[model samples]
Target chain A: MLKTSLSKLTIFILTGFLMVFFIGMSIVFGYTNTSIQLAYEAFTQFNESNEHLIIRTVRLPRALIAAACGASLAITGVLMQTLTKNPLASPGILGINAGAGFAVVLSITIFHISSLQAFAWISFLGAGLAAICVYVISSAGTGGLTPMKITLAGSAISAMFSSLTQGILVTNEAGFEQVLFWLAGSVQGRKLELLAAVSPYLFIGWTAALMIAPRMNVLAMGDDVAVGLGLKLGRIKIFTGIIVILLAGSSVAAAGPIGFIGIIIPHIAKKIIGLDHRWLIPYSALLGASLLLAADIAARYIIMPREVPVGVMTALIGTPFFIYIARKGLSQS
Target chain B: MSKYYSFRILADKISFLIDKKAMIKIGFLALLTLLIFIISAGLGGMPINPLHVLQVFFGGGEDMERLVVMQFRLPRIMVSIFAGMALAVAGGILQGMVRNPLASPDIIGITAGAGAAVVAFLFLFSDHNHSLTVSIKWMPAAAFIGAAIVGFSVYFLSWRNGVTPVRLVLVGIGIAALMQACTTLLMVTGPIYRAAEANIWITGSVSGSSWEKVQILAPWTIILLIIAFLSTRTINVQELGDEVAIGLGSSVERQRFFLLLISTCLVGGAVAFAGGIGFVGLMAPHMARRLVGSSFDALLPTSAFIGAVLVMLADLIGRTAFGPLEVPAGVFTAAIGAPYFIYLLVKTK
Candidate 1:
């Protein structure tokens, strides 16, 4: 583990560099296959050629959305793990993503609203409602939110929302075509303006996550220990909860309900750096951004001309890691 | 009045006590299930009267009525009811063996595994004309194999010394996500028509169920239900927690494996015919518990009847409620089951 702050900072900067490199890879490669020179020219010199337009409009926004959503989801994962004290807890597993996706689909099919801003607010409302429902349901019993209880509660809620979403899609075929890729969780075809709508919430979530990293360290050391140390447990939890909703909700709004990045990146960060949230949070963001950018790039190539959604790519990658963690037992966290 | 009725045979070599109140509740549920079956059968596109459904049953109806009732309605009704019964029984076994109220077949990935397999089967077997190259009759077999494969994998993967309930559940969740991902991947890559067809199946419908499906699923489900019913004692013992059950000289792991197998087979048979009918397993058992306490013998039968009723009603509403759209029964079940699930979570203490 990196004991010295200098070493942690060095590695953190290195990861940020790696993230930038992957972002570049994401931009340069796709179905159209632009070069670094072409990508550079697209930004520096505006000639509206087919490749340049694809580079400037299509590739860059997708890359940014993937990076931002990945980072947000990963930070959300760190906060969720700390808040629930469950290693397996993430927005997707806990139904926040499904809830947000469900809200978007519901509005699309029912109200026919396609506005990006509407998606942002609707997803936040959905994510917040699901989070509260899960918390309330799991906390209702005697033990007050055991990991098992919360996991079950979350999975149940996730199933409910997804099934309901399927119901709507089954009934409305046109809406089905419109929302299928989004529901499958992709960072493709999203415009910069789409990212622009939810970035402010994403910014607040990132800033708040970094700010609370120290208290999260205390909170991670068991509830009794944190209480003995005079942290206002309830307020901190609510604060973290809002941040989670903001981060997870906005990302789902932007790129559908991408799975597994949140759960996978936090653990990867914890493994590289120790459990210190201060370093872990930033490291996780970089790793998450890099991993998703890499996945998004790979997603383009996996199915030839047809792109498999990046969400499916991450799920394909993440399930094995998830099973390994599960097999290692819950106490390993 | 005594609450217990004891049945004995072969000089007390076999004896079991039945709860009178539970028996009464089961009887009532069975009647309710019959009512739903008849109502659903009678109220489809033709809308035969419920009284005329019984008349058709006794071979007294016209040819068109026979075609609609005998050829069309009965098979789908039977499929849904039997599938529902199988799912509820499987779910009851799971909740008991896992010692968790929230445990169900879908939550643990059985239904999803079957769904992925079915979708993959459709995608793989279809020719350039978008029709199956092989007989679609083999889809159930594919679904069964898929559910068994995933069920055993979850059990074996969670096996560290022995499979703890928490580990099994966690592993199952991971596997479930993977299966869902697979389903989505296949759907997206396939034609949009295929995606729509698969979506209807994934959301689960009994619309196209034929007598052939009923014939296969009925015997499979009935045999599993009987086996499940006979194993109620083992499930009851396991429900007391693993340590206690082991202390009582029960082969806890072996019994758990046995119970898990039964649940998987039941779920496989159900999913094979009905597709991924969500939440019937979860909802039925809990509703049964409310009706007839927590005893396995009472709970199992009660849950089966309630499940049959629930799915039959869901199918009923699906076909009848939405004007010509024909929503899948799984949708209605989720509509009711999700809220009830939240309530169960809240009341889980």
Candidate 2:
């Protein structure tokens, strides 16, 4: 009874508590001195003042977008890892984020799509191409897609895309100012309506993720075991791959390619709830949302007056964690 | 008995080279590299006649031609060759020591660590440099100290009982990512002008390289390459695992220490001058192995030559590809080399 009582529900409740607390903190903490009272009043009052406007427009949307992108990327990571059966997999590491970013840049430069939705539509194409490139290139030759090959291929593709992106930026510093925050993976000062543009795809991706979570459990049990249990490996892989692109692309569109959340959150969630995807998925979502909110809040105070990009903050936190895991897992293998 | 002795002597000569075929391949690559070098030096956005390029090189051309070839192009070309040699030798030592193809300085966090340190110095000390020469000279030292610190820390971190290749590579990757973020954060968060300066360095350009920088880099390259060459036998022995190396009377730990030191210094010096130019370290050694085969003695020079050739070509492309608007040499190296690396991954087991 005691063991059962310490269930995933309790974990969910704890995560929820953390999320609400951080969201509240995110809303209240920023350059403009906004009290919790102003946060409540922003929802209640019909005031047209600058302070209330700042609270309603700036902090609120920034916090929400950060959380939304965090959740989207974390879920994407979980799905990618499940599909590939490689613990080291994630959108950032696998070139999906870079791909999405490249597409957004190319569209802005060449097509001059100057609105919110272009990020979503164009990046989706770029993200898909990048993923296919990594997958096809790694799967070639005799060894047939080992973890080592995938990692090497992903990094190489990522390097190429990132180099190209920098080339474009350097050639025309005109685009630099507009995309600086986006390139650095900040949610600050982004147009809030862009959130509305990307939300639908994220929602679809999330729903797809949940639907396949149970199937993912059997798939994790190696290919032969999954086949013995009557799972359609091909269909499952294709579905998971699509969800990964959607979620990863949307996050890149909405925010820049905020990394490590996707890679780290799934690991954190799994530790709390084990490998049961039904439990893991929600835990990952909650933790990711809360963590990014916390990171955003910290980003505000780190170098006061001017804030670092939340991406940098997350990288600082996530890098040590990654190193720890890499040290442990790779050494044992 | 005499016949048997002569046969053994003949076999010893064959084994000295490992393969005649590989030696011929090395010679072919060397010739190809010389041809490319001459072509690159002669032609650019401002074209010089190839015969006149030789004249300009030997101090006999017209004033404008001399200015373009000697004062500008020659130094840039020399830095590319030196930087490439340094990086390739460093990488060759690392890969040979680790027995893993993925163990380049770039992959293993050494370049990023050194780069981050250089950024930190610029952000902290640019105001106090007092002169341009002082500011320029301090960069390599700062970068060297940074690489040493990072290299030592990474070495110690991976040294739990003994270092394993996988653990080292993994930890290196994680640390490399972290250092890059630190670098970017420093660049992004600083004032715009400093940020631009840091950004150019981070991308690995040798633009505006002068005779002074070539002087600084050349000696380091020559000395380090020589040291690296002498350690080939030890590195080859170290590749056969610790127990086997011990059985062969090699002090595995001491040799490994020296090899790591040599690689770190070579890489540190190169990055200090070139601003973390990458893929040469990783790409050149792999190409050498396939082209010249892997007898460490022959392999060292072959890899160094390949690295020099690759970077010279890359720098040539970077300067000329878009005319006055230059792409950084590092960008060209990565853009071209990354695909080939993937192809290598496909080809290799």
Candidate 3:
């Protein structure tokens, strides 16, 4: 019991360290590499100069967007994997990204909606619908919603939405250039207002997720065992699913379908802190935020003066981790 | 659905029988491929009769008709059919060796790996070298090498004690996603000027086929198909699961490695020519299995036929659906194949 407390303390300290590190990083790396003093000054003092303005407006907001979206996606990914009992399950695999992307395209093409708040709602609706479709389809036949079925159904659903998105984008040439970076997913130059708009959903979702993490431990003990342990399986499943969509939907709305973080962060957290959701969930959130902010920093510097998309950097980093987990865990299973 | 056509004598001692039914299925599939070829070839610009398409091939039509049939439609259709057959056969071998219906070249990251290499080739050479024609010449070889590397990585990555189909599949999906990300990175970072072109390539089209590509693709596809068909006996053994295959005294590891080699080659060659068309790999084997049962010998040819038919039909729909604005066959096939796959998923035990 004492050892457990020590481990928890270690995790909290590590997470705190990463949070500070990312905050420092968000201020330092950009067009003009600022002195740490200037970075601090930009935060405290109001300045209209281009460098301070960049630090103040661009870098700060971009960092928060990255952190918020990354944290939301990573948590959703954990819920997805746990709920499905599949190591591979993530927002991308479960059609949330594609669903939200399709909604964005639909809003642009049909509804002609340009606001972030509207996209957030549309994205959530699309995500919820896609999740429902995937669940219903996978749950239809015998041995309801097996990992294999969910995987297949998710693939199909993702394909369906992406195709629809491609169709709309191809025909509606006006939306193409506008959506280019959005589709690729970046935290650069985005308005803090967008992040502000979606923060409530994320906050509620995170709180709900944390509240249920202990119960998720019960649910993770397999269906028969969980039922035997006096857990209501249906309520847990429905609640778990709602939180996943809430988290995933907002992230996609804010960032336009960032990949790999959702899948990768939980694995990193698991490697560090083991599988208890109580610790795993928060550890994953902090780690995911740090990773995304770091990737965004690298994304800015990699091409120098020009930036690669944040999505690209995450994919590059997360894939090896993904491959590693697949090797170690999947092979054993 | 099947007719007997041949007898085979194995080892001159215990006769290993070759069912005639498999050959008949092959023959029917061949007929379907040829018929689809004729019909689809006659489709674009103005819809000509299949007879006229044949006549145009024989130099019996107007010059415009001949050009449309032979130069424009025929080569692209031939590429589509060849690519489809190669992918389907690759999928067949993977499904058989891996003992999972989910196993496909695309799922295993081969196509995406190949795609990433080609995109790199495009971005790198086109920018610094300004020698796209030279790089295009080596694109197929580069894609082949990239796919082989990815295939080996996935195979070895999944190998622990011995590989299980589930593990291999899981690893394949992870690697596939990563490789896809690399392709996206190239498109996003390299230059925005080429974004439109890069977009089309990512979607996996069979457009812009020349007679030269068709010529290279044809022999390569046929050779791979023959090799795949000859492995029918080994595929048959592997299908009964690993324990049974081991019980039957075959070196399951060696056989699986060789099958992976064949699938990598087929996918590498096809994707080199046809970009990144997906779902044909997953859908064809399932369709063939429905028609001809689980036997690889029969399933091979039937799948090849169905794959060729599916892609050709997708191409026709893609080219015609938007008229002046032709969608890639990959898009149409995805639209069709994803639904069928969902249906198959729901149907599976």
**Which candidate should be chosen as best, given TM-score against the real structure?**
1
Give me the overall lDDT of model 3: 0.81
The digit string of per-residue lDDT tens for model 3 on B155-198 reads 89888887777767777777777786787677776665555565
The digit string of per-residue lDDT tens for model 1 on A215-283 reads 999999999999999999999999999999999999999999999998999998998888999889988
Candidate 1 displacement at residue B116 in angstroms = 0.4
Instruction: Please tell me which model should have the higher lDDT, number 1 or number 2.
Output: 1
Instruction: For candidate 1, write residues B1-349 as lDDT tens digits.
Output: 7888877667964455679988988899988888888888899778998888899999988888889999989999999999999999999999998888888999999999999999999999998889999998898899999999999999999999998998999999999999999999999999888889989988989998999899889888999898888778788889999888999988999989999999999999999999899999999999889878898978999999988988898998999888887999999999888888788766765
lDDT of 1 at B137: 89
Model 2 chain A: lowest-lDDT 10 consecutive positions: A1-10
Estimate the TM-score of every prediction.
0.98, 0.91, 0.92
Regions of model 3 farther than 4 Å from truth: A39-44, A109-112, A133-174, B1-6, B10-29, B127-135
> Regarding lDDT, does 2 or 3 come out ahead?
3
Best by lDDT: 1
For candidate 1, the per-residue lDDT at B130 reads: 95
Name model 2 segments beyond 4 Å from true. A1-6, A140-145, B1-16, B128-134, B234-257, B347-349
- Tens digits of per-residue lDDT, candidate 2, A209-267, equal 89888998988887789999999988888788888899889888988878789779888
DockQ (CA atoms), all models: 0.80, 0.44, 0.49
CA error at residue A209 for candidate 3, angstroms: 0.3
Using DockQ as the measure, name the better of candidate 1 and candidate 2.
1
